[model samples]
Target: MTTTTPRLTGEYAIDPAHTRLGFVARHAMVTKVRGSFHEFEGTAHLDSEDPGNSRARVTIKAGSIDTGNQQRDQHLRTNDFLDVPNHPEITFESTRVRQVGTNEYHVTGDLTIKSTTRPVTIDFEYTGSAVDPYGNLRVGLEGSVAISRKDFGVNWNAALEGGGVLVSDRILLEFDISAIKQK
Candidate 1:
């Protein structure tokens, strides 16, 4: 096969093995904590020529959160945080996709966590594309968005010894995606 400009007008599915759904938040007003959800699936329809016509959707399992520490990860699943039992899934559905600059996009959508839905905009940069050994066309992208945990009904927190809280109110949601074009 000859290498050429990657097509951005087809449907694609996120390759879980090459994608990461993660987050970062301040811990105890000092350090930062990073974690990721191991289970998720997403798809997108690209229309590079008409970016506004593009769309994407994703669903993540709340119980799949991994923070390196088992105890803390479990705690996050409790009512104080994710309340995974009550809300088994976190989801996002893009309402608009706009190309802001060369290979840059602003995706505005409704993000639902713990059954509460709110609008958010995630800025993404298209990393590039390639054809894998198996003849699969893949596209890469990285993006992130900051959001308030409290707004998602995850109001759990504890006061630190000196000042501030155990976890920061602001959370950074990150996405590293490698999507394979669907035939």
Candidate 2:
């Protein structure tokens, strides 16, 4: 006889319009280049009483990268950076969630960029949960992670006469996501 597993309920899908997947990197050793993913999707599954059991996944379309400059965005999608033609998407899948405080967690996951999967940890915060005006159960989450661009094969650079590189290797990822519960 086949048995049915109990439906695991706290399912939610990311609200793409309201969610932001942003990144910041030092530019020209004097400024910062800030950009966001224009197309992405994510989901969250959590237990109301025990958020430690939560699971999450996010997928980002490489071509949707935008920094408010069309030329720069195109360059970023080329071989010098994301190489969108060869690597269509970047993805993250949580492997574990460790609660370190009342509302803080270290979310460890596998982040795949340009087909290379690496382990990453994000400092996460569960803001709260609420029922929106549309009657959808929603949850808010925020997190940040820092990673080296070179680690993901984006090694393009230019040396400046002043002795610094045109870009910094470290990139900071920031996320403010909201997900609507599944019926």
Candidate 3:
């Protein structure tokens, strides 16, 4: 029998319905454009007692990018941006996890996009945990990290008539995770 209030440890799967894998970027050097991937899967091995033993992995379908704009979404999948046809997925693999403060952690991982990989460290906060109606132990976490899109081989831009570029170089990756305990 599974305990309703189990400790946050062991393997778990990220619940897609309750999770958000999104990104934000400055548009026209003035406003921000937000979008999220509609398809992704993630898993984690949580060791709350010894954070160093914790790790996570995620895979996002590149073509699943959505910004509520059909034309723009299609363009984003071209060679100028994600090039989804060539690179169908973006992935992350945590290399280290450390507890920084109460219910807070820093996760350093290798992020791959468009065949380019870079190390990124994201700060995550534990929101809370609960046992759902299905008797599943769920844990909540939120995190974000900023990265230069050019660094990931996503260097596409349009020059503005006045100044600056259409899309900012830095892109903020966001994560809202609700994971179900598997063990």
Q: Each model's TM-score?
A: 0.96, 0.93, 0.96
Worst 10 residues of 3 by lDDT: 1-10
Candidate 3 colliding pairs, count:
0
Q: How close is candidate 2 to the true structure, as a TM-score?
A: 0.93
Off by more than 4 A, model 1: 1-6
What TM-score number comes out for model 1?
0.96
User: Against the unseen true structure, what C-alpha lDDT does each candidate score?
Assistant: 0.92, 0.86, 0.92
Question: Superposing every Cα of model 3 onto the true structure, what RMSD results?
Answer: 3.0
Worst 10 residues of 1 by lDDT: 1-10
lDDT for model 3: 0.92
Q: Write the residue-wise lDDT of candidate 2 on 108-166 in tens digits.
A: 99999898889999998868777788989777779999999889889999999989999
User: What is the Cα root-mean-square deviation between model 1 and the actual structure?
Assistant: 2.7
- In model 2, the clashing pairs are none
Prediction-by-prediction clash tally: 0, 0, 0
